[model samples]
Target: MRTGKPSKTAIKVSSSIVTLGTTSYGQQILPDGLVDASEKILLASGVVSEKGVRWIKSPRMVSVYRAFDWLLPGQFEALGERKAFFERQVRAGIAAGATQILVLGAGFDTLGWRLATEFPKVKFFEIDHPVTANVKAKAVSKLGRRGNLYLIAEELGKRKLPDVLATHGSWNRESRSVILAEGLLMYLPAQAVRELFGQCLAIAGAESRVVFSYIPAGPDGRLDAGRWTGLMLWLQKVAGEPWLWSIEPQNIRSFLEGIGWKIAPELEGGTGRHSTEYFAVATNQA
Candidate 1:
């Protein structure tokens, strides 16, 4: 990371590596999948030796978990809720007849690898910046063979996300699909987020679902109405990935409604230390 040309995607994906390690050591959330995913990350990053993999549980990971709580007050509970919501949406998508899933800004998430068997017929696509995507793909290829699972490496240039999707693989506008924007929306500007949704609308069928995570803030564009806002900002600066958008919780349903989506009542149910951040699952039913 130091010698090579610095990459923003690399920093973001590295954060994911830390998160996966934290999840692996803790008994609270997903351990097995993250542990498995961390192994892939380690291999991709060239720490293939057995002794190197054990570093996941070292003091560094412990520091990350501690920092996690400091960033969000009741972080463990909120994060656990986020995990449950994500899993629920996956099941819901399958039940609703979704045959494809496109994970936007996938970063180091391993859902495509972990949940492949559960929904054997569904095609899983993990999309990210080319730099990170290439790193992840190398590691994934080592994890046996996966045909239905595709790793899409591309840049989000000129708000042409849908075009990028079609170029990389199939973009079936008529088929039922779920587009996941986990841990991504907040990093984008308002216009960029709107553009992303616009493309989503173009290719998504009536039953298509969009499940995403967003941080909550009050009016005047403040984060958490000013609670831990400074700390969060500082952390983002240190990580070199500042969060750019903070959606008001009360206005979420109205916002998506304006964009042609029918908001699920339970979409805003989880995530947050005293409700500073939240996740929502929406779909257009036209």
Candidate 2:
């Protein structure tokens, strides 16, 4: 990430979130009202342009997404599925009496914002890179204060989650929590990813759930990218956020167990909506 500027990939993902929220296909996966709220945040932060919003809502946007889907092959829809999965796990956690909610690498996601309003008593937190968090914080400020929502700025890979979160008075390590790490693990080094899971377990109370997404390696133990692999990798490289790690589906169970988490059984054959990417829900309990 560049100094004084957010991650280019973060900005791009935010734009995609807006596009998914605005289109008819997107509404099927994500709630319309939440998508609208996210769009407002991106617009205020200047991550998305007004003209782009107009285009996404127009009929012509169908052609654009169709082309992207053809080229990217389920990449666009995967994001929507990830968001929806996160929201479901969070909601279930909240209903089961979890109080502290944490979103890692939140980018411009509006889950914290929307849920904070609905469940004002719950403490909601989003930890992101300083550059991206700062932009989103300023945009959220314009919308009005959400007293229950806290945005913390820190480079996730550089600091230990327990140490950084300890500085915040509102963060409670002893409380039951829902920890979210979406579109984040692949960006971190392998060691960092292991440490992250350990840190979350350390910070969480009994029965706490951790929801995350990961890319799965192919039969040859390499990135299982689509036909546009070169283009996709090049785009990420240009954005300064190249992929760094992947876990085979077979290894997920042992991997999570090593970090003291038990993988949940809700996933379809233990894979997420996309063939290349997968979302896992795990609990601190054995």
Candidate 3:
């Protein structure tokens, strides 16, 4: 019952980290064309240094990632809905003539690489840990893909995210780009989540758009007290990321609206296999 900060080792054992090893079902769910293209990009970058490859191939990382993958597919199927939602958002941004993208807690995500390739006119900033960012950078470099892909080496719930984004360049508010925080909100403390969102809102312009995913609070408004509570508990015990917060669907909508964001409910019903809870995308209205 004593909840404390996770150890360094525990942090390293994240479910997203396991996706790097190519063992998780994420690869299967992702479009084959995208997967192959991303791999090629990483190989050509020389940025996919030996260290990057080794980290992805580590047995321990692979095992943990796979475990999380197995326990959460039903949940994942819901989360996976975000992929299409993201695609649509990107297209909307492009059509609207936006030119910049900010992806928070990017994990080993290939969205930046893919979007950059597809939308040559847009710039992408992928914020993640230094080690992970470096690996991704190398891969992008090797792929010889051309786009403004900035890798910010910093922790998501730490001081470095804001600093890295500011150092990169100011957001082109005139055109209104998109900021994505996919599958990331459920892992942080409520205060941290609010702080991060505050920072994002501050930096984002009225024309800017933001999209993210969150776990809905159970009927009792307690974390992990739902049907999937047992599974979540097991995942936390093994993967080491406890459920910190769970907002009601309506509450999330209200929270975003209060922050001057125009909520676009992509995932409804709930965060379950048949539900759209996998992910949702929204934009800053003001």
lDDT of 2 by residue, 1-286 (tens): 4557876766666567667766667878885476678778888887778987786556666567767785568777777777777888898899989999999999888889989999999999999999899999999999876999999999987888998889988988999999998888988889999999999998998989998888877777776566766687777677778888788878889999988999987632355547457888888875
Provide the lowest-lDDT 10-residue window in model 3. 1-10
Instruction: Report, for every candidate in turn, its global Cα lDDT versus the true structure.
Output: 0.68, 0.82, 0.60
Q: What is the lDDT of residue 47 in candidate 1?
A: 33
Relative to the true structure, candidate 3 reaches a TM of 0.71
TM-score of 2: 0.93
Where's the lowest-lDDT run of ten residues in candidate 1? 1-10
At residue 268, candidate 1 shows an lDDT of: 42
Clashes of each: 0, 0, 14
Model 2: lDDT equals 0.82
Model 1 stretches with alpha carbons more than 4 Å out: 1-28, 45-52, 157-159, 267-276
Residue pair clashes in candidate 1:
none
Q: What is the TM-score of each candidate against the true structure?
A: 0.82, 0.93, 0.71
Q: List the candidate numbers ranked by lDDT, top first.
A: 2, 1, 3
Q: What lDDT is reached at residue 120 by model 2?
A: 93
lDDT of 1 at 245: 78
